[model samples]
Target: MHRLPPYRLRRSARAKYLRLLIRPEGIEVVAPDGLPESTVLAFVRQHSGWAQAKLAELQARLAKLRQGQAERFPAEGGSVPLEGRETPLFIEETGGSRIRVSLEDRGLRLILPRACGAERDRYVRDALFGWMKRRLPGRVAECVQRHGPQHGLYPRQLRIKSMRTRWGSCGPANDVNLNWLLGLAPPSVLEYVVVHELCHIRHRNHSRDFWELVSAHLPDWRQERQWLKTHGGGLIQRFDPVFP
Candidate 1:
């Protein structure tokens, strides 16, 4: 039998089955309480190849994250993504309680309190999200209006919220819920998620019919989806602290 490498083990009362997680720090095993240590070791050995591959992937992702951390937000001259393009963020003190933001010459200018302290990042994040909330509905509505008629699907209600694990969801009564995080993705990626959820109105599940409908409208949706899968984590990591 192959000896299992050293790994952290956690027992969970609510866990129904054993699970392995590869993290930046190391591999962690989560098992139900009272699971025998020998069984855990056997499971680790059974999936050693998968565990090794996942560990390497985690290392690569951590390296990318460390590189990305150098690019912080709300600095004197930082950059923020707007519709997938990197636009310059300019901060100017206006000596007022109100924070104002504007777009000019392909850049974003923020007019904010001159004496903003530690809360400045929070203020900027809130203001930017406010702007996105006000603007995203219209953008989503436009995408729906453009594509809904073709697929014979229209949502009765569209709701936007901050989500942790999903980009969008389709619910009863033809309601579609979109994550505010979509604003951070490229416009094409956001459209893909919108079309994806809208297709659910026709086919309730991720069945062949649902994907066919999505493909009929956006042929290059796979590329957009892949882009989200690869780059979306950074956006979420960057803003999660603000939202949390």
Candidate 2:
């Protein structure tokens, strides 16, 4: 028999019988309380065909998303979305070891020391990314204070950094980590991310109660989340350029 995708068996008291559910995380097998491990495996084996088909669909969807993302990467000296606007980029080489990215009246002004080809690209990428990080803490501090009190959740510390695969994460220690790329997204998107992480401070898991809390604050969170899934990939690839 063909094996199923990665799955975990859960014993739920509310489960009347063994049932297989496909979720974003993976396949979940909910068995009635006191079901033996062997019985759960047998139940999963019977649904292998169904689970494999579903996961293959997921793979196809992911591949399509990546293909769409590839078409959106911003080229150097090209425009990129900054603060919800398509900001132009300008690069200039000057004599010095100083590398800086500045926002001028026209667009972003990148000052690079004598560098060429791949080296130049690296400097441009790093300077823009570093500038974004430095600019994020102040941008988000007000947001945290604005939303934290209403929900009664306050993070002990707030940090903004580059996380390739995550938008934000709330640690158990009451520290919230927001992605630096969020500074490029619209203010609404940034606000949504802040609220999401703040909610995590109270609800560690995405149970029904957790989602209710999220919905209460941001009724349109699903829309913002979908936007991230579709457009966020391009931003990620833009920051992570291949150098050889």
Candidate 3:
């Protein structure tokens, strides 16, 4: 009723029905090609009530993720969610200007030079981002090993980085690109995404066959998928250190 929250209308030739995807930033309406704009507009307006409620919940979740930035990074009591649990951060001063970052079983460790206090936060962010980049490829390989053999599916190459719109994508050649921010999510969530992309290598679209393939490998994938739909946006919007 209130003019509907912000929305972007995407016309997809492959889209069979109008779909509404709600995220923290706004709404995404995927409409079949050649559909009338008026029809799309009406469809969105029809779901205004549901969309509003979903958006409110997402906004609140993101706000909680942003609380006490000091407790998130580059300060005392810093923590981050890793593998579905809050992982604490610890920093130790080294004698040189270089920063050393490593992931221990206990938590993330940052070795920063005492003289770099003026720019510690920036340096820590960069180091942690690098660690994220390094962390994802190994995980993807592990997922492929666990799920790819029987199906004979493997990626041409794996490219990991911080992506804004999607968690992962499979190229025509089956080279996979994954968003590093996914590392912050639960391990199951990450595997679901990896499996989703791997399926794309065989079936380019979201056909029944593709979904069957996914279900064959991950029977509980629907739960992880739902988790991403509900919490993934906040991971990208509020918890991505590069953006923060």
- Listed in order, each prediction's TM-score against the native is 0.67, 0.67, 0.65
lDDT value, candidate 1, whole model: 0.83
Weakest 10 consecutive residues, lDDT, candidate 2? 68-77
Q: Write the per-residue lDDT of candidate 2 for residues 100-137, one digit (tens) a residue.
A: 88899999888888755457766777787889888888
Model 2 lDDT vs. the true structure? 0.82
Output the TM-score of candidate 2: 0.67
Per-residue lDDT of model 3, residues 123-242, tens digit only: 766676788888778887899999889699899999987677889999988989998878888999999999999899889999999999999999999999999899887766545545
103, model 3: CA deviation in Å? 3.2
**Cα displacement (Å) at residue 84, model 1:** 0.7
Q: Alpha-carbon error at 33 in model 3, in Å?
A: 74
Question: Candidate 1 on 43-121: residue-level lDDT in tens?
Answer: 9888878898889888998888766654544466677788877788888877768788888895888877977876777
Q: State the number of backbone clashes in model 3.
A: 0
lDDT of 3 at 92: 86
* Candidate order by decreasing TM-score: 2, 1, 3
